[model samples]
Structure formats: C-alpha cells, structure tokens
Target: MIRRRTLLGAAALAALATGAFAQDDKTKVGFIYVGPVGDGGWSYEHNQGRLAVEEHFGDKVETVYQESVPEGADAERVMTQMALSGADLIFTTSFGYMDPTMNVAAKFPDVKFEHATGYKTAENVSNYSARFYEGRAVQGLIAGRMTKSNKIGYIASFPIPEVIRGINAAYLAAKKVNPDVEFNVVWAFTWFDPAKEADAAKALIEQGADVVLQHTDSTAPQAAAAEAGNVITFGQASDMGEYAPMPRVSSIIDNWAPYYIDRVQAVMDGTWESKSTWDGIAPGMVEIGEISDAVPADVKAEALALKDAIASGETHPFTGPINKQDGSAWLVEGETADDGTLAGMDFYVEGLSGDIPN
Candidate 1:
C-alpha cells in the first residue's frame, strides 16, 4: 500500500510541473483600447486584429484587453497592471495614449509596447500609423462628384497632425475635382462619442453640407447622415457598411492583423525590436472599402484609379501648387510634400476656412 501511494504522488507532481511549464510557454499579449470593441469603428477593428492573433496562434498565445480605457492616468494604470500580469507585449491603440504608454513602458523594460497613430519611440516601445490621408483623397473625390450642395462636411477629431493631414488631403482632392467645392469642418474633439459625432453630422447637414467625412471613430456619423437623407458619408477606421449604398458609401478600413501577428511572432522568437511603421494601401495597411452602387459609375472608376495610382506610387496625395492656410506657398507645382512635413503637419492648406483649434 505504501509503495502504491508513493508512485501516485510522484505522478501528481510531474503533472503539476508540466501544467506550469505549458502555461509559461504561452506568449501573452495585451491591448488597451480607448473605446469599446463593439463601437463598430476603430476599436472594433482593433479587436478584430486581436481575435486574429488568437486564431492564428491557437494555444501558443494568450490575449487580454481592457476596452474603453481613458488615455491618461487610467491608461498608465492599466498598462502597469497588464505588465505585472505577465503581458509580454502590449498594444496601446489610440493617439491619446502616447504619453501614458511611454510612461508605463519605462517601468516595464522587459515588456514590449506598441502605440498606434503616435510618433514616439523608445528602446522598448514602437509607434505605427496608417497613411489614412490616402483614403481621404479618394473619399474627397467621390464627395466632390456626388455632392449637389458643393459643400462637404468634415467631422474632425483632435487637431493632431494625423487629423490635419486628412482634412488637407480630402480638401485638396475635392477642390481639384470640383473647383467650387467647399469644406465645412466641425471639430468633435473626441474620438468615439456617438452623441457628439451625431450632433456634428447633423449640424453639418443642416448647414447645407451634402456630404460628410469623419476622422473620428463610431458609426454615429453614418447613422446621422442616414437620418438626414440625401447626405453621403465615408466610413472611418472601419467599414461601417450597414448604412452603405447611401449615407455610408466607401470606407478607410484599418487592417492591423498582419502587423499584430508579426509583432507577436517577434516576441515569441525573442527578436522583438523597436521601430516605427507607417504603411498605406500599397502594403495593405490601409484599405479602401468598396464603392457603393450609389456612386456614379464614372466617379467610381476615377476613385479606383486614384486608389491604384496611390498604391503604385504613381500619385502623392499632397502634390504641389499647394499653399498654407495663411496663403504662404507650401509646395510648388510638381513638388510633392515630404514625409517630414506630412508627419508633423499642423497648419491647414489653402482654401480651408477657420483656424485649427488651440
């Protein structure tokens, strides 16, 4: 009887050891979102990437996330907790989380961090963003051609370089297509406020804007446009296609799965390094969604051609003969804007009214 008990005890110990080893072998990834995963826009797309990671790695990886995390002290706290909880890699998916991501990364030197739509980097942190302005150019062309009022509405988020670049790119393309086109920008200042976004869209529509573009997340703008009728919109950050063929025509879909999978693989291979990645349609980072049947066949053809040109490097969205809002020559004819200027873009291009908020 004593001999049999000893053998059973040995078997139990061995099983426990194997279980612990299995748990330790899995690479754990963390994500901090600024909005709920079901927002059907930015965070939703990010969550899709996370799901993709899980699906790809199977039992080799573990993923965790905290949705709707505010981008200040709360974000830092979440990052710290995730790090403490054995997160090998954490992706902070919002521009506002930049400073907080840096702060948390300093304390957890072993853990890798990735920030989206930000420009900061450190030894343990990397930054990445899509060239969304490329998509905006296509949207602008469609808007210019589709709008009866010749007045386009833009629902802007914060006045960051990313937002500013989008507004400029859209305006430039629209103005090129329709010389009489005008842009009415309403700054919502928040990334995913449904009510605020809806209000902004309504106000624009009321002000004679027959078309709307947004840099903010959430499908509220699309819904608002649908309700307003005769107003068209483009999906922001994700394909909010439920309102398609009318209010929501085309979209700029953020495809983060490839990047996320690559980064996580780096962690598992012990080859993770900090670097910035800014890719657009060419590399499949930013995708232009389907142009709906509502768009005229000619305009749709032109938009697709523009997409192909941008992807093939045959077109630069900020091609020259452009001026700053103050009427200063920013780019001479045939002189495309450099990466430096576009990265740190702050001022509005010529023909855009009102000042960028402080």
Candidate 2:
C-alpha cells in the first residue's frame, strides 16, 4: 500500500505538471472596476470583458465583479472580498489600482492577478494594457483633417503616461495635418465625471474649438458637443454612433472581449502563465470606429491605409527625433522606440505644456 505521504507527493507532482496547482481545482476570477458599469466608458468596457469571461468559461468558472470602486482603501476591500469569494484570478482595471493590487498580491500568493495600465509584477502578478496612444494618433489625424476652425479641443481625464501619450500623439498628428492647428486641453481629473467632462467640452467649443476629442470615457462630452452646434466628437471604449448623424465624428474602440476569453480559457486548460501584453491597432486591441458622413472620402482612405500599415508592422506611430515636453531629446532623429521603451514610457513628448502629476 502506498504511504499517505507518498500519495500526497504524487498528487502534488501531477498538479505542477498540469500548470494548475493545489486549490486551483475550481478557478474563480474577480474583476474590479473604477467606474459604474452604466458610465458607458472605461468601466463599461471592463464589464464587457467580464461578460466575455462568462461566455467562454460557462459553469466551470466562477466570476464576480465590483464596479464604481474607488482607487484607495476601497480597492483593498474589493480585493479582500474576491479572495474570500475564492478567486484564483483577479483583474483590476485601473492605473490607480497598481499599489493596492500589489499589496493584496502579497496576501494571496496563490491567486493570479492582472492589473491594467500598471507596471507591477510578481510571481503571481502581471500587467496588461492596450496601445491606446496608437489609436489616439489616428483620432488626431481625423480631427485635424475635419477641423474647420484650425483649433481642436482635447478633453482629458488625468496626466498619467497613458493619457499624456494620447494628448501628445493627437497634437502631433493634428499638427502634421494642419500646421496652423493648435490644441487646447481641459483636465477633468476624474475618469468618468460626466458633468465636468461636459462642462469642459462646452468651454472648448465656446473657445472656437470646432472639433472635440476625449481621453475621458463618457458620452457627456458628445452630448455637450451635440448641444453646442457646429462641433465634432469622438467615442471612447464603445461606439456612440447612435449619437452620429451629427457631432460624434468618429471613435476609438476598445476590443477586449477576445483577449478576456482567451485568458480564461488559458486557466481552464491549465496553461495559464504570467506575461505582459501591450497590443495595439496591429493586434486589433485598439479599434477605430466608423467615420462619420462629415469626414471626407480622401481622409478616410488615408486613415484606413495608415491603420493597415500599423497593423501589418510596416510603420510605427512614435518614430524618432522625438523630444520630451522640456524640448530635450528623448530619441535621436530617425530612431524608433521599441516595445520595451514604449511599455515603460514615463515621460511626455515634446510640445506638451502641462505636467505629469506625481
């Protein structure tokens, strides 16, 4: 007869071989969102990912999510609840969740955690974010081509690297399109604060901004643009074309459904591994929405062809001779930033007048 210790050893070895350790018999995943699911913006996109998980895993996976969670102690509470709920995988979708996620990671060594827009990793922790700035370059190009005022307004949430990169890319592309074009930025500080975002949009429109772009995730800006008359807007996270026919000129869509499904399936198949993913337009992570009737045909052709080039690895948006916001060189002329540099970007590009808050 096999000794009890011997039997236990055999079981442990088998579990290790399958990539699913003990206590992983039933995989449970938890998602934490920074905004309400009804916000129809950042939180909404994440919730969509959660639904994708359900669709892919069915009954084998137990999934739970808490929305509108603040980035402070509240995040700790939500993570604790997920652990109590017996989660084996948790995805915290917010940059502010970085520290809190790392804190909770130490407490639950067995649980696998994924944090979006954050740069932290442990044996059990990984980071994943889409190259949203790539899409922003496209958005800026469209906005520049469509703007009649030679003035563009950008509605921004925070000064994080992600947001800063977007603003700079948009500004650069728009400048390329119309050298006389100048951009004005309004910082709302809150990711989904519709009222403030709307107000910002109004201010920009009143200031001779004929086109409005947003890094904030809310239709409030679009609504504001619609009411203001003679303004164009873009969608975030989802396509707000229902608001089309008018102000919403185009959109930058987030396609996280397929990736979410594949991750869950990885766990189910006992092949889940920790790694970072920073896919962009090329990998279909950042999708551009339909161009409005307002956009001219030639502009559409140019943008679509550019999209294909980026997706097929023929070009890069952040090509060289780049400068920091301080006018100092960040990359030499004709030098391109590789994946590693872009992934760890902690500086602003040239021509940005604002500061990246600490």
* TM per prediction: 0.93, 0.89
Best by TM-score: 1
lDDT of 1 by residue, 165-188 (tens): 999999999999999999999999
- Identify the runs in model 1 with alpha carbons over 4 angstroms from their true place: 1-23
Q: How accurate is candidate 2 locally (lDDT)?
A: 0.80
- The collision pairs in model 1 are none
Q: lDDT per prediction?
A: 0.91, 0.80
Candidate 1 yields a Cα-based lDDT of: 0.91
Top candidate on lDDT is 1
